[model samples]
Target: MTVPLAATDFHADLDLALRLADAADEQSLPRFDAADLEVSLKADHSHVTDADLATEQAIRDILHAERPDDGILGEEFGAEGVTSRQWIIDPIDGTANFLRGVPLWGTMIALAVDGVPQVGVVSMPALGRRWWASAGDGSWTATSDGARRLSVSTVDSLDEASVSFQSISQWAQAGKTPELLALAERVWRDRAYGDIFSYMLLAEGRIDMVAEFDVKEYDIAAAVPIVREAGGRMTAFDGTETLSALSALATNGILHDSFLSLFRDLPRA
Candidate 1:
């Protein structure tokens, strides 16, 4: 018989994740929309700003000083110090938005233990908002008013649910426009909230579902715990519980299987 993995406390790790976000915010927030900000294109044609590099390096510097044994996988910089315990960083989750003076962008940080994200943090400094969660601790968010525990909407029927499809072009590019349209038709409303904010809205119970394609571990790792802790479910488009699958579908826990069923006939990614 196989035994379940023992549950571990992540309070400390969650604290560290929040601190990492603070460091990231300090480094990147000031650079937002700066006239002197430097910009460049990565080989993949994605935007990379000086803020991205500085924010990621700031987080890395803290991990190196405090959690030296843990590994890191960042969007701006490649992986480092391979280990079972890894810190995933996306200095700026929406670089284009950031450069365009949109406040939807933020910094993401997560601590994945043995491949499962145990702690997650998303800090939108420009908006003066933040959200975070750790295994068993429950998800929470903060604004100018104060902090409150997060909970996903209880809507169980797709016909009554609200959804966010990050990009229509992304759906077309993946050849899943038919499936996307079908799902959108089933829902009461559909919007393109885009980027990390969409998932955070799901956690806040303001939205019922979020589906997007062409993502990476750093793109969604920090969202896994936040969504789950908020009483929601998140998985790859093919129904796998992994961050590396390059796709994501998140919904209130009651609506997860139903959402996955919509894509059941599609080929696995």
Candidate 2:
């Protein structure tokens, strides 16, 4: 049966996004923890596999038939329309974890209007969790018990904050490791939460900040709503509306500006 994903209110869209996630989970979860996969390197050497392609195709097919007017930009398929109202999807946000059976992977889908994300959903089926948000009604999450609203932590001081990073190799390759390392040094603590979950935690107020370089639109688009709707700030390291795919910083709103200053001294190499 096809769930229409027809929602009229903010919470309704949240429900629909989650329902879309449920559909996604049904297709992807059974394939996880599989011993054999046709994993291989892409042109840039980032890992990809049959799961990524098949999951994306399933989501794309649903969107195409359900909301034909809406555009879509997927990790596997190229852009499908010329409209500002577009859906950005990363069928599995942490492919590495998915391939390794790490249970840290999740599906990501976002609705971006004129490049601004207004709806976001992240579903980690293996972990049995999901989070979603709309532009106004606020961000939220679901667990085994029930759903709950999310709010960023009130940790006002960077010296007392914990920053969740994406990856060391990602930062090093972007030539921004020095700045990233310095930021880590300034923070009270750091951990590599890599991929969609870090920002989701930021939304839930469990983590104080996150920064990373070398990301695709699909990597962070769905995450923006979860963060912003929770009252955190997400943007380029320098506080721009958007940076090229290589740079981003997300923090509880209070830490954004002061935190960006820590990057002023990133030594060029």
Best by the TM-score measure: 1
Candidate 2 Cα outliers beyond 4 Å, as residue runs: 1-13, 265-269
Instruction: Write the residue-wise lDDT of candidate 2 on 1-269 in tens digits.
Output: 00124533556556666767877898788889887777989887889888888888888888888778889998887788954778888999999899888999999988876677778999998988888888777888886678899999999898999898888888888877787778788899999998888998899888999988878888888888889889899997667776244577899888888787778756666
TM-score of 2: 0.91
In model 1, where is the ten-residue run with the lowest total lDDT?
1-10
**lDDT tens digits, residues 1-269, model 1?**
01126878999998888889989999999999999999999999999999999999999999999999999999988899965899999999999999999999999998888888889999999999999998888999986678899999999898899999999999999888888988877899999999999999999999999999999999999999999999998988888877878899999989989988877865565
Instruction: Report the C-alpha displacement of residue 28, candidate 1, in angstroms.
Output: 0.9
TM match of model 1 to true structure: 0.95
- Per-prediction TM-score, please? 0.95, 0.91
lDDT of 2 at 106: 94
Model 2 lDDT-worst window of ten: 1-10
Model 1 regions more than 4 Å off: 1-5, 265-269
